[model samples]
Target: MPLLNNENKIPCYIQNQLIHDKDIKSIVFVNSHLPADETLLVKSITLVKRITTVSVVNNFTKELNLNSVDISHIFIFLDNINDIPSASSAIANQEVFSLNNPKYYFLFIKPTDNSRDEIKNILDQVWKCHELWKYVLVFCMETEWLRIVSYNPFKQLLVEFQSDCNNTTMFSNMLKNVNGYRIKTIFFYTLKSSKMENGKCRGNDCEVMETFFNYINATNEEVVLNVTEDLLYPVSQDYIKQDRADVMFNNMFLYIELYKYSAFAFAHSNVYAVVPRASTLTFLTNIIFMFTPIVWIGIGIIPLIYYHLLSIFDNYAIGKHHVRGILISKYVYALIFTCIFQSMIITTLTSPKYRKNIETLHDLFESNLSIYGVKDWMYMFHREVAIRYKPWNNTSITSALNNLTLDGAYIVGEYWLNLFLKNKTRIGGTYNDYYYKIKEAVGTGLLTYYTRRNSPYREIIYKITLLRNMAGLDKEFGYREINFTKALKSKSLTLIHLQSSFVFLSVGWILSTLVFSIEVITNIILQHIKTK
Candidate 1:
C-alpha cells in the first residue's frame, strides 16, 4: 500500500485509498515528456489512471532517475517504430528492474501510416526488446487494426530446463513448436557420472536432444557448482551435487528450502559427561594392568586352585587336627577382599556426573565435553562454538554419540539427520531426546536452482516461484512445520541399559586379575622357604 519515492513522504489523501481499498498495486509510466494529444492512449486505460511518472531527460547520455520508487508494472509508449530502440534502452537503464519483486511491462504503440516495409521494421524492434523485457503486452492505438497482431501465449517465454538423462528428451520434445525465446539447460558433471560420454554429449542422440545438442555440448555440460555457497540445498547438497537435474525437472514453480526444526537440534535438558585428561589416563592405566592375557588367565586358574586348597585344608584339619589349616584359610579370604576393594575404586573414578545440564552456548563452552561433528559441517559449527574438534567421516552421528570420549551432541543439517532419525532404531538415545534445538539459530538458507548469470529464463522462473508460493504448492515439495519443542514419546531401552554395563564389566575384570597376582607371589615364597 505504501509508495516509495526520492522524497520519502506519502500523500495524506492517498492514505485513505490505500487503507479502504482491499487490493493494492503499483504501476509506473515511463516517457520522454510527450504532448497531451499523444498521451491520450495511456489516459484511456482505466487500470493505470494513477501511474507514477519517470520522465527521461532530454540529454540522452544521462539515465532516468527512478530512485526509491517501488514499481510493480511499467508502461512504455512507443509513438512510432523509430522510437522503439531509444525507449527500450531508457527502460533498461532504470534501477527498479533489479529489485527482488515481480515486474510487468505493457507496450502502447501508435498506429503507423507507413508501408509494409515500415511494419516489418516495427516487428523487428519489438522482437529485439522481447528477450529483455519479458511478460510484455502489446497494444495498438487504433482498435480496428489491433487484430493484426496475432498473440501466442508462449511467445515471451525463456525456459532453462533441468532434468535427468532418464527423462530423456521428453520435456524438450513436448515444447518444440511452442513459439518463444531459445531455451538453455543447466547440467551438472561429476567424475563418475556426467551428461557426456567419451567426449560426446549423451543428449545429442535423441531427436529433441539433437535440436539442443550444440547448446548443451560436451564442454558446456561439464560444470563445477558451489551449491553450499548459497545454502540453497543445505540438506540436499549431496543429491544436487550429483543429480540435481532430476530434482529440478520434477519440481515446477516455487523451489522452497525446507525449514526443518531438527537442524538446530543439539542435546539439551539432559546430563552430559565431561571426560578429563587425568581420569582417561588413570582408567587406561588400570585396564592395561588388569586385562593382560597372562594375568587374566591366572585369575581364572587361581580361583580353581583356591577351591582345591580349601578341600585340602578341610582334610588336613580333620586328620591331624591342625590350627595351621585355619590360618591359611583366613589368609586366602583377606586376598579376595583386597581384590574387591580395588575394583570398587576403579568404578567410582570412571563414573560420570549427570546432575549439571547444558542449555546454552556459554554452558557448552564452559563444559569439558569435546564437540565432534561431520567434516563438511566444520565451517558452520566453527562460527558458533569455540572448541576445535576433529571432523568425523562416513559414520552415523548418533552412533558416534555413544563414545564417552566425546560430547553427547553434534551439529547436522535437517535433511540427512532427519532421514536418519526416521528410519534407524534409537541405538544411543530415545526419540524424545534425539536432538535439542539450540537457543540461537546460526542462520537460514533459501534453496534456488543454480543458473548462469544474466539468464533469460531468470524472470520467468521467479514468476513461477512466486505464483506457486501464493497458491501453497510448496507444501507438496516436502514442506513441514518446524516445532522445536516437540519430541517423541517413546525411549530406547538398549541404549540406557548398556551405557552403565560396559563400565561395570571393565572394572570387575581388572580387580580379579590383581587377586590372581597375589596368589602366585605367595606360592613362590612358600616354596622358597621349604627349599631352604
Candidate 2:
C-alpha cells in the first residue's frame, strides 16, 4: 500500500541504477517509455548475463581478471531496442567474448531486416573460426504484422504465410514432370578401341540395336528409324581381311538398313524388301539364263554384224568393185539370213508365253546324255541330282550342287566359275578339285537356252538376283556357272525344243537355199562380165 504513493520517481531511478551496476547478469527494462541510452545498457548487460552466474562467477573473474563483488539477473524492454547501434556492438562483443566458452549459448531479439544480415555475419564468423554451426539460432520479429521468423545455419526453415496451404499437389506435379520426361532418339556411338581391333565387329556389342519399327507396330508411336551412318568400319583394321569377320556384322547392318527402308516404305506405302533363298531351282535356272552363252552370243552378234557391214562398205568405197563388191554382197546376205534364223530359234526357245514342260530338277537329272554349253554347269548338276544324293538341311548352295555333281552328273562351265567352285570346295574335299575340271570343260554353242522357263520360282529368283546386282552385293558370292543342259531341260525350253525345232530347221534350210541362189547369181554375173 505504501508503494502506491504518487511519487513513482524513486522506483524508476532505482531500476536505472540497478541496470548500470557491473554485477548485473540479466537486464529487463519494464518502463513504458525507455530512454535510448538506458535500453542500450540493458541489452549490453543481457549479452554477458551467463558470465554473472554463481557457478562460473569465479571462473569468469579469473579469466577476465574482474572483481565479482556482487551478481544479479537484470531484464530490459525498449520499444525499438534493435534500432540502437549498441545492440549490434553488444552482439559482436558477445560473439568474441564467448569464444573461450564454446558451449555457451545466446539469444538475440532483432528486427526482420537486421536478422538476415546478423545471421549471415554470425555464420561467416563460425565458418572462419571452424566452429560448429549446428547450435546457432536466430529469432527475428516483425512487430507490425505480429509475425516471428526463426533461422538456424544448419536447418532449413519453411514458413508459410497462409495457414492452410496444400504443398503436396504442387510437390507431386514438380516431381512428375522432372522424373518422367524423355527425348526420342536411337543413338549408336562407335567407340575407338573396337574400331582399331582388326577383324572385329564394328557393332561394338550393338548387334541388337533398337528399332522404331517394332515400337511403332506395337505401340503405334509415331516413330521413325534413322540410320546415322550407313557403314562403320573398324578403326585400324584392314578392310579386306576384316570383310570376312565383318560378314555377319555387315549382314546385320544391311538388315537394319533394309528394315528401316522397308518400314519407311510400308509406313508411307505398301512396298517391302524381299530376301532370296539360294537353294530354289528357280534361282539356279535364273543363274543359268543370265550366264547363258546365247545371251552373250546375241550381245556379240550385233558388234560382229557392224564389223562385217563396215568391212563391206570400206571395200565398196575403195573401188574394189569387181572382186570385193560381189564377194562382200554374197557374204552379207548369208550372214544376215543366218542371224535371222538364229534369232528366231533363240526367240522361240526363250518365249515365256509357251511354258516349259519339265517342272522339277529330277526331270533334268534323269535325262539321256545331252550337251551343255553353260559356263557353270556344276551348279545345275548339283541342284538337280547330287543335292538330292546326300541332302541335308541347312546345306550351302555349293554343297548341294557338289553333292549333285558327285552323283554322276557332268557339269560344264567357265574355268573361273568361282561361285560354284568356291562353295563346292568349302563342302566337298575331292570334288572341290573337280571344279577345275568342270571349268576346263566349257565349250561354245554345244547347246544353250534363251531362258529357264520350267522353274516355278523364276520370277522371284530373277528379282532377287537383279536387286542384289543392282546394290553391288552380288560380288560377295562371285560369278555362277551357266548349265545350258539343265536350262534346256526346263519345261519351257522342252516345249520349245519339241515344237519349234522343225520350224528352225525349215528356216535354216531356206536360208541355205537363198545363199546358194545368191552364189549362183554372182557366178552368172561374173561370167557375163568376163564375156564383155
Candidate 3:
C-alpha cells in the first residue's frame, strides 16, 4: 500500500476500492517516489499519472489544460508542506479550462501538514475568487478524517457536507456519489422567447423549455425553480449580468454576444415569416395574355377590316362579290372566336397567377412593399435590419394577426410563427395568401439557453438537452413550415389567390404603354406635317 505516512495503516482507500468502469477519467499526481517501471502509471487505478516538482507544476498544469478532457477526476499527493502554496496556484488554474466542464478533486497532504488551518489556507489561496468552487468537488484527506466541500447549483452556494457515519464508510460513499451534484433554487428568465399570459409564461419556446425544466423541476421534490417573464431587463445578457437570472430559457444567438457565459443549446430553430403573396395578373389582362399580340391582329382586327372594305367595294364598284351570295360565312369566324374567348375566361378564373414568392431575404426587402417584424425579433437580429427602411416595425403581438386582412407582410419569429398560423387558420377557416409563411428561414443560428460560465447546472442542462433530443420531447414544439407549405398548395381559392391574374395584368400594362407611345408619336408627326 502507498503509505499515507511512515507508520499509518489507512490503506489508501481510493487505490484499493475504486472500481474503474472504463469511463472514469482518473489522474494521479505525485511529487516524489519515482518508479522505474512506467507500466504502473498506465494501470486501471491511474489512467494518467505524472511526477511533478515544484518548479515544473505550472508547466504541467498548462499542458494538462490544453490536452486533458473537459471533466477531470484528479488525485493530487504532495510530499512537502511548502509545496502547498505553489500547488495551490497550479490547482486553481485548472478551474479555468472550460466554461461547461466540472472537476472532482482529491488532495492529500503529508500527515504532518494535514491541519485544519492548513486546509483553510489552501482554500483562501486557491478559491479567493468568488464562486469558483461552483463546478468543483474538493476532497481533502486526513489521517483519521475526510473533509469535503461541495456546491449547490440551484441555491448558488458552497456547502460543506455533513455525515453521521464514520470517516471510512462516508469516504467510500462520497466517492460513489461524486458523480452527481445537489440542486437548490434556480432562476429562469423566459423574457427572450415567451409571452406572459395572465401571469403565466407561455409560448412555443416556453413549451420547448418545459420539455427540460418540467422534467427537472419534478426531478427532486426539494428543487425550487422560479420561472419569470419579467421585462425589467430588456435582454437576456442583462438578466445574467444583474445576477437576477441563473439561466436564459431561450435567447437569440447574436453576432456580438454580451455575456461570457457558456451558451447551453436546447433548441435549434430558424426564423420564418408570414408574408403576403401578391397577384401578378388581373381579370382583363388574363384574356389578352392568352393570345400573342400578332395573333390579336390576325384573329380579329385584320379579318373584320378586310371584310368591311370588300363590302364597300361590292356595294359600289361591284365585283361579283361571290355574286350569287354563294357566301363568305362571317358566322364561322364568330363561332370560332366566341369559343376561344369562353375557354380562356373559364381557365383564367380558376387558375389565377401571382408573382413568384418573396422566398429570399434580398427579394423580400427589394419587393418594395412595406414589411413588419416583431419588436423582439427586430431587436435581436437588429444587425441585419439596423436601418428602419420602412416605418412598419410591429409594436405589439396583435399586429401579426392584423396582417390577415391587410396588404403588407409581417415577420414572425420561430416562437410566434406557429401560434400566428393557428390564429390565421381559425380566422379564415380556410387558406389565404395574405398571411402565408415564406419557405426560407431568415436567422443566422440556433436559439440557445445561456448560463453563467461557472454555473454548476450547465452539465445537467446539457444532459437534459441530450436526452430530451434523443427522446424527441422538444421536437414536437420546434419550428415547422411543413404544414404552412401544404396550406399554400391547397386547391381552395380566395381573392388573395389571384397570382396568374396578376401576371396577365402586368402584360396588359406593358401592351397599353406600347400603344400609348405609338399614338403619341403619330399625333406629334401629324401636328408637324399640318404646321408645315
Question: Which candidate number would show the highest TM-score if scored against the true structure?
Answer: 3
How far does residue 360 in candidate 1 sit from its true spot (Å)?
7.3
Best by lDDT: 3
Alpha-carbon shift of residue 528 in model 1 (angstroms):
45
Worst 10 residues of 3 by lDDT: 49-58
RMSD versus native structure for model 3 = 12.7
Q: Which stretches of candidate 2 lie over 4 Å from their true place?
A: 1-197, 203-329, 338-392, 396-398, 401-532
Whole-structure CA lDDT of model 1: 0.37
Per-candidate clashes come to 2, 22, 13
User: What number of backbone clashes does candidate 3 have, counting pairs of residues 3 or more apart or in separate chains?
Assistant: 13
Stretches off by above 4 angstroms in model 3 are 1-23, 26-70, 75-100, 106-193, 203-234, 238-244, 251-268, 273-356, 359-412, 417-436, 440-447, 459-532
Query: How much does candidate 3 score in TM-score?
Result: 0.47
- Residue-by-residue lDDT tens digits, candidate 2, 88-148: 2232233223222222222223334445566455444442233222122222233312222
lDDT of 1 by residue, 2-68 (tens): 1122121111112222333333355445542444432443343333445443332333345455563
Better of 2 and 3 by TM-score: 3
lDDT of 3 by residue, 1-532 (tens): 2434422222243443233222344333434232442234334344323311111122434635334443333444555445555654554445433332433343333334445555555544433332344222223344345444443333334445532113322222121232223322233433345777897767644665555455455232122333333332244456554444556555555323433454554555666655554444554565566555555545555456545644643554333433222122344334544665576555544332322344555444544545555444554343544353233434343444553454555555555566545443545653344455656665534466665555545566666666656874466455533332211221222223333433343343444444445555666787799999
Q: Over 4 Å off in model 1, which ranges? A: 1-24, 35-72, 77-95, 98-130, 133-182, 189-441, 450-532
Candidate 1: which pairs clash?
Answer: 254-465, 266-436
